[model samples]
Structure formats: structure tokens, C-alpha cells
Target: MGHPNDDTDKHLRGSLTKQNKKLSRLKCSVHNYDWGIVGNNSQVARLFALNSGSDIDPYKPYAELWIGTHESGPSFVDHGNGRLESLSLKTWISDNPNLVLGERLLRSGAVLSAEKALSIQAHPDKDLAMVLHNSQSSVYRDDNHKPEMALALTEFEALLGFISVKELMDVLCSVPEIVELIGSGNAKQFLLVNEQYRDKNAKAVLQSIFSQLVLSSRNKIGAMISNIKSRLLPEMQKRKLTDKEQLVLRLESQCPADAGVIAAFLLSYVKLNHGEALYLGGNEPHAYICGEYIECMANSDNVVRAGLTSKHRDIQTLLSMLKYTQGFPEILRGVSLNPYTTRYLPPLDEFEIDLSILPQATSVVFPSVPGPSLFLFIKGKGAITAGISENDNVEEGEVLFVPAHTEIRITAESTELHLYRAGVNSRFFTIP
Candidate 1:
């Protein structure tokens, strides 16, 4: 027979053990937005199905797999015993801030295999975000500014920033319907100023054209779209279309008569192959067209959308918020961190991403980071060891939360493993 105090001691010890766990498995959330890829075709669906032990429904759309403490789709800690605690990830972090060191970055994986494009939108800068959140809390969900980076998992296409003045001028000359829509006066002024000054007044000119396109009457936009299709369809059949023309046609088919079809021509068209990435700063306009990617951003959901979505459109706000910088956005191929790892560090203090590809029977040790991180295994099998915790058999689609200053080592088991680690940018903190 044991002492009566033994049970109490065991319970206390158990609670302490749970509290001292520096690495924990996380059960992430999946959003089924209409823009997501449908069924097994979606990487989001595959990951969700793998994590939840649920079968994939062929008709359902699986859009985003969220692995953060965001209020909208908060993740949960998985206790490994098939039971979940009532506290969400956000609540847990709030309750135990010391463990995570008050981290505020959000990480998510996305897939866009649908016909429709994402919204033509720009996120507010910090000051504007605070004002928008305070003035219109219902529309702008959070006060944090969102400067994001998207790392391509597959072939990805997007319209990012404004095209160069020369490219815009060429587009204007080629597409007469755009001239008709923006009015001959504005078009002529844009062409004349660019030809004379050579981009000295590019910002003002781009802003004028974009504002006119967004504010155009729906009937006028529809008529212009019809005329554009009539003119372009014959040309498309005769010869290979330019990337801009192809995008216009694609957007038209996806959301007919939307102002974004015309607005897209003013933006730089970007296509990224696997392992590539692009950074989107605040107030920069962009729209993801298709493919799978892992995205990391500051903790915010505030979007000022102009067009190409069924969601709310803040035309005036979007027009006012744009940077109106004209050029090709830079594509990133992450800097090599080690033989098995690469790091994608954007020019922001909020967040960064590290990708590791480990072959079978290989082991890699990651040094301690300044803040908490969300580590996700997107492919194959692995094992992780951190402090006293050992995930002996981590499978694909598993997410783990690593506490601040906790070093972790991963070993690929029988197959090659692909992992992405999301955390605050290392430059934000000093590593002693």
C-alpha cells in the first residue's frame, strides 16, 4: 500500500511534466473557402485529412491550413492520446506567454486550384491598420500590419505590384478597350507623360488609371469586357497570347466583367516555379492566381480589396493605400542555411521561413531561435527531439510548436522529409 500523499504527488508531477514540455504536437485548422482546390487535388485537403484522421470529401473545397494563434482559425494542442484540451492555441499562448515569449507571427499553407483569382488587394501599413481597425472594426478584423511572403510549393502564378511604365504604355497601346474604359484623356496623358518624362510622373499616372478602372460603372466595365473578349479571342486563336493577355482572358473567364480583369494589366505578372518565393510589403497590391504555397505574415486579417472577389470591396481605401510603384517584383530563392536547409528571410522583423529537405537516414540539428516557432512536416516521415520530449514517429502533415530557445533535432526515417519552420526573423533578436 502506498501513502495517501503519493497520488497527489503523482498528479502534481504529471502537471509539471505537461507544463515543461518544450515541444508539442499541434492540430491545425483548415478553412474551406470557395477559392480553395477541391477534394484530393488540394494539398490543403491532403494535409487536413492526414492531420485529422478524416477522409477527404471529393466535393469539398480545402483552401487554407492554418497553424497559428489567430482568432479566426486557432490551432489546438494534440495530447497524443487522441483527446484534445478545451483551450485553443491562442488561449494557451495567452495563458502561458512565458513559454512562447509573446510571439505574434501567423503561419498558414494555401492552395488555389479554383477558377477564380484572389482579390486584387493591398494590406494597410501599421499606422493605417490601427486607424482602419479603430474606425471600422467590422471590416478590418485586426490592427496588426500584414507584410507577407509566399514560398511556392508548386508552379505559382500571381499579379504583383505595378508593371513598369514602359510595359504599361505597351499594354495601353495594344489594348484599345482599356483606353476607351479609362477615357481617352487619361490614357493620352499617361502615354504623353511617360514618353516625355520617362517614369518621372509614373506614380501619379498609374494611380489615375487604376482609380478610374476601379470606379468605372459596372455596365461600362461589362461592355468593355465584352469588347475585349471579342477582339482578343480571335487573336488568341491565331497566335500564342502574351502573358498579360492570357491573364486577362483567364480572369475574365473566372470572374466575367470584374474590374480586376482590366486592372490586372496595370500589374506585373509573375510566375514562380517550385522552391521560389516573393515578398509582399504593406500597401503593395497583389492577387494570387493559382498553385500551392506556404505563407507567413504578421498576425492580421485586414485586407482592402478592390476587385476579383465576392467579398467586401473597399475601392476607395484600396485606391488610397496603394504604393503605386511600377516595376517587376523580385523573386527569392532562399539563401542556404546548411546542406539540408534553406532560409527565406524577408525584409521585415515580423516573420521568416526555413525549409529543410532531409534524405532517408539523415539527421540535422537546428540551433535555438529567439522566439517560438511553428514547424510543419509537409512530406515523408521524421522524428524530432527537443529537451525531454521525443516525437519518435512524426508523420507527414504534423505541426509542432517549439518553445523559445529550445534547440531541436530532426531525423528522417525511411523516406526523404520536407519541413518548413516559421518563426520571427532572427535579426529581431540577438543570439548570445
Candidate 2:
């Protein structure tokens, strides 16, 4: 067994959180491979533990961690309950106070992903979450405007928010080649609503126009992509910028610099390493994931994507939930280390954390462990024997998942390790 941890020192935190002293390791629920990982920086987080279940074969550097609940294959872990059980996140956090931090975390989970790029769709506010839930049982998970954050494992790339009308008009005008096909009917509609299009709304309208033109919206936007392949790719060959072009250039071959790229002009691009983090919360929306990242949020699984997904759009659903007036959507967090490790904070309660090196066996116990947690062992192979539990030892790439109110001890016996955790929350308690 590794050194025992003061549960209170490691887990129980708040304003009164007595500044964490002992290096801590909290378990989490990292779901089935989801959004595409940004293969950039990770040696900064230093959390690359040895886990048997990974995609890139022998494991390179630990990238991003996916910890939301969009269903799609929520990661399953070994529950401490005698048998290894798989539980959907939604059912586990019922009435769990920490999980319901003012109806915020759920809002974040319903959106982000790691595998297939999620479609561009907006989520309803509190009232709408209930209304949609009543009207269409499947789409609505809860009624909280979800805002999120993303810290670049290395230079991060994303298509966030909307572009102003003036900027979009310039992009549309640049590619006069397709003006003939833009059709007068919807074209006329755009002119009619032109005044209302501000930032993201304007971008969404442009995407809608482009989506209509795509030889196939439901299919691979392939034909349309092929049509513009020759002309738009010139910029990439001239690629000289150092920071981040939103990494959109990399996807140019796949998406082409069509009306969509311009209409969906990336509002901002950020590159972070070690301790930086991105916050996505409220109704501000964005899509596209590329890199190794650790994502965490509340406990619900529902996403209403419009562009990058093969699911439902619910036009009325998105139109009703958009933050039409929102310009800048989220707050970007910088990196700061806690002695040996670094913690990246997202908008909600959960965080995307990385520990540099595991010293023999450092231990930590949530002063108050969140009721429901599913820990995904992305990397690192170790013998995990929890607090006197009879279970033998868990190896690398194994999920050490625990249910609500499960307080236990953990130790990582490896040179270095990587783990992803989501939905770590607990009720309010006065330090006794």
C-alpha cells in the first residue's frame, strides 16, 4: 500500500479549502473514446500513466482527457462494489448535491466530445431543458445553459462562437465562384435577416446557407469538399504562422475553405501546456476537437449537434436556445502549478488535471469524495488496492470506477501516470 492520505486534506475543498499540501489523486469517469484528441503538448501535464486501453498503439505522450456525458460510449470502469459494473452517468448522480452545482455542470457535459466532431448546435436554457424534456424525451437532459472550457495540451485548435456580419460578408464575397448556386430563395431570406446576424448568429446563418448547398448534408460533405479542393488549399502551402490558425489549416483537406470555414471563422485560437485550461459554459457554443486533452463536467448525457454530427438537428430546438447576443463566450484559464503537478480548471466544478511524476506512491482521499465517480485509466499499469477492499490489484489501462459515497484509498506505483476523471462533486460540509 502507498502512503495513507488525509481524506480531508486531499478531497474536502471549497473557499475554506486549506490549500492542498499533500499531492493528491482523485479518480474520475473518462468515457469511451469520444472527441478527436489534439496531439500536441502533454509532457507539461506529465499525467501519462500506463493504461492498457489506448488507441495510438504503444502510447505516445498523454494528450487530452475526454470526461463528458454525450452517451456515445461513456467510458466504463471497475466499480468498488464486489463486481466490475458499468453505469451510465445520468442514473448515478440523481439527488447528488455536488453534481447539481446550480444546474451548471450538466450543461457542459451535454456538449463536448472526443471522437467524431460534434455538430454545431445550441442547448436550451433551464426552462427549455424542461420543456424540451417534456416534449421530446430523448433530446433534453436538463435545463442548464452549458458553458465549457478547453486548455491546449499543445497549441489547441477549435471553431468557437460566430463571426460578425461585416467579416462574414467579406468571406462570402471573396468566393464569388459559388454565388450562382447560392439560390435566390434562401439567398433572399439571408438578406432579409441580414440585419439580425451579429457574431455567431451570422456565422450560423452562413453555415445554414452552405449546408443547403452541400450536395449532401446528411452524407459526407464530400462532393462539395472536392469541388473547392483545388483553389482553397493554396493558403496551407504558404502556412507560416507560429501560434495557432485554429488548426483549421490541417482540416483544410477534409473541410476545404468553403463558406463554412469563413462563416464558422474561429473566434480565437489558444495554445497551452502544463497548467493552462479553457472554460466553456453557459449557452456560448463551439465545436471541433483536435489534441490530447482531459475534459470533465457534471453528470448528464445529451447533445443537440447540427453540423459535425450524424444525428438530429432540431432546427427549432437550436434556434430557441442560442445566445444570439453573445460575442466572447468563455474565459480561458492560464497554467499554474501546485508544487510538482498542475491543475487546469474548466468553467464548471470538475477540472482537467495532470500530475507530472508519481513519487513511489503518493496518496490522496477527497476530504469528501463525490458520490458518483468513474475513473478512466488512460495510461499507467499499477497495482491499485483500495482501502482494505479484498479486490486484488488493478493494472494499467483499467478503469477504477467508484459509485456515490465511495470513500477509498489509492496509490500509483509507477514512474509516471495519466488518468482522466469527470463529475467529482460532493455536498457542502463545514470542516469539523
Candidate 3:
């Protein structure tokens, strides 16, 4: 038999240990950015309304819905006591890293639901992130490279990466203002260099054009926009506009005077249908033009913005950190693990995503995960009958945390159940 002192010691140790539940519900944090779609039209706002079970204000601009342990918008654990505990996700995970993330995912953190156009920016690599974080902690919060993937929740539009050298050359030749920015001599030289280096070093050739355009003067940019409007506006009204031309018109509405208006022509414009995905590595320059998507990044919030926003612009840093390359954008559809589930796998070891769409009154069993998992219910109602959490009710926009190695069985109530799971894949823990 244990002594009274021994029993007391055990109790104290239990209290000190993490109070996290095995399959606890999560109370996520939300960000109201200026770029967010106004009123209850915001998807983030709708999700928040479902979680709170209240009437949406319809006027608040809910820009982002964040889930995970990142300090910027850390989610809170729901203890099911009719009250949410004050403990943050990051601190809670730190208290029991192995239980939550296991060994692989302990290094990474957080997921996001972005509503409107995110800033035109790129993340620094790991080493550069560290230097930036250390030097300017306020601006660069964490020392982690953000290799993010976006699974389109709705039809999403973004300016991703660089356009082809030949295409860029055509724009340069066709637009008098673009020709003026780099001068006739340099433009001709760039074309010649592109022809010579197209097969060998395309990225370098693309970089030369991008650098000149990005570094152009405000007056030059103004002239370029004016010229574009004068030349293209009449044609835009007469015929079916191309995607790139449409983007120019959209940018004209948003920020006509901004240099990004000119810069947009240099980048490839992409639109992802619902359920499709896109992967962006660190140092890639991109700007989300519109629509909603689920964004998962490697636990960092360091964005070096160049333009298309009212926020602080870090043009020099952005120019210095970009990975200049041109290619047709690849839209990832994910690997289908089953009829009901598809897994989106990016190159980064930090995170991966699985989307499940269950039919009406159907039961689906998720394969046991080797690491901690985050599940977000996007559509319909469901009851999760999983290890340690029996008959737990999950509805649209509800978030859940499933501990490592826990068996998961979700059943649709009366309608289809749609959810996405993010976790560290088994590859990270396996010794190859």
C-alpha cells in the first residue's frame, strides 16, 4: 500500500502533467484582416458563427480562421465544461509534445483559413528566417521557413511564380511602357539572353527581367499603368479577355497605381477549383487574388511584402529572398487513399493533409495516424466514435484534435460529412 505522502506526490505530478484530452474539441482563433470579405459573406465569419452558435454580425470582416499552436493565432482546447480553458495550443503542445504531435510534427505548427487576397509576399529560407527573426523579431516572428500548401475550399485565384521567357518577351515588345522601363537596349539584350539561356538557365533569365521591372520607379509604373489602360481598355470591352488580361483589369480596380499592377504580368495567374490544391515552397513570390482556401504552413508568420497592400512594404528584403523561376503552375489533386479520402502531400516534412467526404449515413474509418492530427469539419453534420471520445458531436466548422495512434471512426448523421485532416505523415518517424 502507498503511504499518504506518496499518494499526495502522485496527485501533484498528475496535476502538473498536461491536462489535454485525447480527442478534445478545439476553439480556434480568428483574424479580422482589412482585406477580408466584408460582413457575414466571409467564410471565416460563417465558420465562427457555427462554432459559437450565434447570429453573425454580418458587418465584421473575418479574414482568416487560424487553427494550431502558432502564437499569432493559437487555438484553444475545449474541455467540454461549458467553458473554454485559457491554455493556449502552443503551450499545451509543448507540455506534451509526444502525445500531441509525436516526434515528427513537434517541429511544425499551425493551419489557416484565408478568405480574401493575402499579401504579395514570400517566406525566407530557414537560415534567412533565423537571421531575420533574430534581427527584427517584431517583423519576423519565428525562425521557420514557411512552405505552405493551399487546398481550395472555394474557387481560389492567385498570382503564382513567373511566366515563360517567350511570353514575357512578347509583353515587353507589345507594351511600349514596359519597353521604356528596362530601356530598348536592355530589353533587346534580355531577349537575346533568354533565347540563349532558355534551355540552360531559365531562372536566371527570368530573374533579370523581374529585377528590372520590380526596381522600376513609381513614375515609370504610373506611366506603364496609364499606357496599359489606354491601349487595352477599349479591346477589353470588345472581345473575350484572356486570364492575364482579366487579372490586369482586376488589379486596375484594386491598386491601379501600384507597381504590382506591372509585376502581375510577369507572374502566372492561376485559379484553383474547389478541392484542388497548390504547393508553394519558401522563397516563391505569390499573391492570393481572391476566394477562400485552407492554408497550412511550417509554423511561421514571416511575410516579406513587396506591394498590393497598405501594410509595411519590405521591397528590398523581398527582392533579395525570391527564388526566380518560370514555369506553368501545377495544381495538385492529391493522392487518393480511398474512395472517400484523398491525401495532399507537399515536399516539406512539416505537414500533410487528408480530405474526407462521407456520403449520407455512411461510416468511414480513418487509418490510424502515427502522429498528432488536426481535423476540421467543413460541411454537414457528423458523430465521431473514436478512441477515448464516444459519440462526440461534430458539425460544420468544428475542429478536433486526435491524439497519435488513436483509432478514428466517423459516421454521418443524416447528410454527408466533409472534413480535412492535417498531420505528420508516417515517413517522418520511419527510419529509412
RMSD, each candidate, Å? 4.5, 9.9, 4.9
Query: For model 2, how does the per-residue alpha-carbon lDDT over 149-196 read when each residue is reduced to its tens digit?
Result: 454434444556654566455445544433445655544455556365
RMSD of 1: 4.5
Error of 1 at 234 (Å): 1.0
**Of 2 and 3, which scores higher on TM-score?**
3
Q: Which regions of candidate 3 are displaced past 4 Å?
A: 1-21, 102-116, 189-194, 197-205
lDDT of 3 by residue, 1-432 (tens): 122365654543354354443576778777777778766777788887776556666777777777776566667765645356555555556666666554344324333334445667888989899999999999998788888888888888998888876777777677677777667886677667645665465566567656776677778777778888888889877887777877886776777677787788888889899889899988889999888888877766788888677788888888888877777679999988888899999986778888899998887887676678888887899889777566877889788877777888898885788898888865676746
TM-score of 1: 0.92
Q: TM-score: which candidate is best?
A: 1
TM-scores for candidates 1 onward, in order: 0.92, 0.57, 0.89
Per TM-score, what order, best first? 1, 3, 2
Per-residue C-alpha lDDT of model 1 across residues 185-290, encoded as one tens digit per residue = 8777777763557578777767887898999988889998999889988997799988888889889988888999999989999999988999999999999998
TM-score, cand. 2: 0.57
Q: Summing lDDT over every window of 10 consecutive residues in candidate 2, give the lowest-scoring window.
A: 15-24
